[model samples]
Target: MSAPVCTIDATGIHVPSYDDVLAYFQTEFRGIYGSDVYLGNDSQDGQWVAILALAHYDSCTMAAAVYNSYSPTTGQGAGLSSNVKINGIARAIPTHSTVDLTIIGQAGTVISTGIATDGTHRWFLPSTVTIPPGGEIIVTASAEDAGAVEADPGTITTIGTPTRGWQTVTNVLAATAGAPVESDADLRRRQKVSTALPSLTVLEGIAGAVATIEGVTRYAPYENDTNVTDGDGVPPHSIAMVVEGGDAQAIAVAIASKKTPGAYTYGTTAEVVTDRYGLDHTIRFFRPTAKRVKVEISLTALTGYTSGIGTEIQTAVAQWLSELAIGEDVRYFRIAVPANLDNGADSKTYTLTDMQIAFNGDPLGYVDLTIAFNEAAFADPADITLVVT
Candidate 1:
């Protein structure tokens, strides 16, 4: 059988005379860097001449189609982002935690600082970001660095995603008896939801790797790992995320939890002297670390329980779920007073008919939790029916 022909940007030639294509890549490389060429065996292995482009390729459509670049680390985002809010949880540090956000263009233009463009619209780092163990934070952005600018029209990149997390958690809240902060595995699981990129910054070196004529660069896929630590009020757990999944929220949750376990310098000069010029500067100050927790919304139905004070449990459940998803503080449920306890006219059977449990953030695609509460503390208690959606 004859060997497969060599091709670059369409024109097919024998492997021996492929220097013409090599020269073409030099032009693109010079535009990005002064001079760099790292080719491969073929576009797949050496970009020189191995075989196959895609994991599976259609020889008929090589130019008008995407390069067969399927590997453990292949470019996956060829389309626009779908409406998907990646979800993940993290633990809070008794002290502080961090939150990071990153916005990237699969194929867009580049701008100064950390902002980028598609020549039409402006995009910011991870548009929607959050800090677990909920608290306040400050945010900012800057380009990867000034020295490295000349990027593709629709492919400029940033250094690391904008990171903001909570810290210095004073006033330790009492821990829940039955359920404590999440475990280490739980934290790692959350981090997995974030994007996993090879470099927080789109390394200037990468342009060289991609444009290699007869060379290749072995790229490693991104990985998320959980780091455990000593958190004061909450059991220690930490995580880190990337932009590989375009899942910065997941990473924000992970980093907030893990980083809390360590000690950080207060937002002041290390000199120990107080600053009169700028002690209140938000940017200079650092946040106390915190742990993030995964939250689920499932309403509980109260049986034979009626709110003499006109408290509707269904409405309360919905409100609680919203707070939980946003990592807000919530306290609810007031039992009857001692005098009104079992033996009284107030004593009546109440049946909590039905409660629909769902997530606050991603309501459209989640399982609802069903709960039933029976009022055994009352005598002849009046039954109350409840419904939730």
Candidate 2:
């Protein structure tokens, strides 16, 4: 097979042309047989030999295509199927968990409930749970919200209500924790380290097991043998995890499944779980607290800037902030990253003259503009007041 062509614009790709393959055969034949005679189309023997070479070339091309699929760096590895294969092989598949909500309503009112429908997106109800009159029952989302509905508390409007007599319906607690489907890069990184060691007793093994549980976004496991005097039930030689997102019950079960026998487990968050063997275990882990950073930007529009630009800036900033992982800092200057905002479009000309930040309704002064943290940071576009001059 011919080698891949290199170009400045295109990444190297293996696509052997029929002419190239035919030329290779011709060169080989002349060099070996010591003859200038060219293979003719009319000759049956020559035609058969050419066909055989073509078949071999085709096989090489197919092999290259297959090899590329296995690599995460290649385009073929971007598909969900490829991601599943990589995760399944590595045993690091991220589990997605349902987002639970406590539906509240008036006493003695029966509300017909289903998934929360918001325009094109539908948040499914995993199971049917009834809300007692004047009380609340927990219902879970069919899939993870990934901090979308949680950032904007009341965005989930269409609660499956067959009739309107339910009076008032709202979730008492915010749906802040749900694990999203792991991205391709994350899956690839996990696969690389998963095979490096056995997951029976080490920290990697424990982390791998917990990661496979639905709704677990991030986790850090620590073995503290020196802090025997410490409270919170952390014993000598005990293992504890600082985890972000995922259901408490599922995380506990995952910890129980992978942890060494008789090893004491401790965390900031605790849950009782029965493993597949019907063995009950109490698991403790830390859940990262979310700090909502309200951003207000005052922009002075250039000549071409339009009214729509304000809304676009708000969306861009919100999405940028939402993508941050646990333990990541929210940098003040990075919030003004111009790439997403300065799109070369007509309405892209705007100067961010002033910016203000608030934590829990208290405006932060210039000295405290940067909210540095190790926990999750949430921001909503609606909460971001963008004023264009």
Candidate 3:
């Protein structure tokens, strides 16, 4: 038998397998000792050689892992986190959801501090607020705990803090849902875009800048450089940015800094950003409208199938849909990949028979969804219907 050795070449690093290393050690033993000597698997010398070969094989594997850690595509976990720093970006930590709460109270009422709740989650107000002449004030409240706390319109009506002269609290709009810790895959994508910050196009630079903002989960930038309004209703010489999960003021500042001079920003959400001379410029951008997507999956149970497998499929599908980029369409075939994720039991438990998707509780269809540029797709595990046969 031939000896196997770790080597690096033009293709890539190659580490010898444990079997290969064991075979090489066996061969060397035969060469050193007499060819007639017993070297069966149960022999003491054979067992000793196997143990030594395993240690050497482990070292070779470690060397390969260390080599791959330098590249973003191959690196993972802490290694990937370190490599992305060269692009001036870091992994986004989980954040709390926020909503604008409409506080109605007596005129001149002073709230040193307050708390609101939707029954399920608690929201915290800023340190102080005073009711103006109108006796109504809108304050942004953040979730007490981080990560995906959602409060729908009018749901946060309970005043958790009993303050004098404070009457009622409610949110007219849904809360901006928070995000989980950034994954390695998401970090790599951001690192790729960050390189374009100093690129030739202004739009790419704006996008690259937005990608680095803390708590910014996803975003897209569109430019209408032509002389007339474009197909997406963006005015001429303007840019429209659709963003999800970030501080509004930070996004506006990034746009104000990177956008071309005299170019207009087109969107529904407006934030006033101050320039170097202290001039306030109202920057416009869009906050993505969430569209709930419904999915139905049909599968036939096999030898090891159980109710738990059905639940896993639902979770996997929901996660994939929620992770779609801004303006990204939900394809029909893509959902199947997650429903049949390659977990050890997936193949043995069941085979997917049919899959369908729909929007807004509409009838499930075999067609793909065409999501608007400013609309983001969201899916809940409860909305995922799994039928086991």
For model 2, give the RMSD to the true fold: 9.2
Error of model 2, residue 383, in angstroms: 2.0
lDDT of candidate 3 over 207-311, digit per residue (tens)? 999989887887989888899998888999999999886667688899999998888999977767899999989899987877889998989999888888788
Count: clashes, candidate 3: 0
Which one is best on TM-score? 3
What residue pairs are clashing in model 3?
none
Candidate 3 yields a Cα-based lDDT of 0.86
Pick the winner on TM-score between candidates 1 and 3: 3
Model with the higher lDDT, candidate 1 or 2: 2
> Each model's TM-score?
0.18, 0.58, 0.87
Q: How close to the true structure is residue 174 of candidate 1, measured as C-alpha lDDT?
A: 13
- Which digits, one per residue and each the tens of the lDDT, describe model 1 over residues 222-278? 112224332211122311111111112222222322332332312211112223554
Candidate ranking (lDDT, best to worst):
3, 2, 1
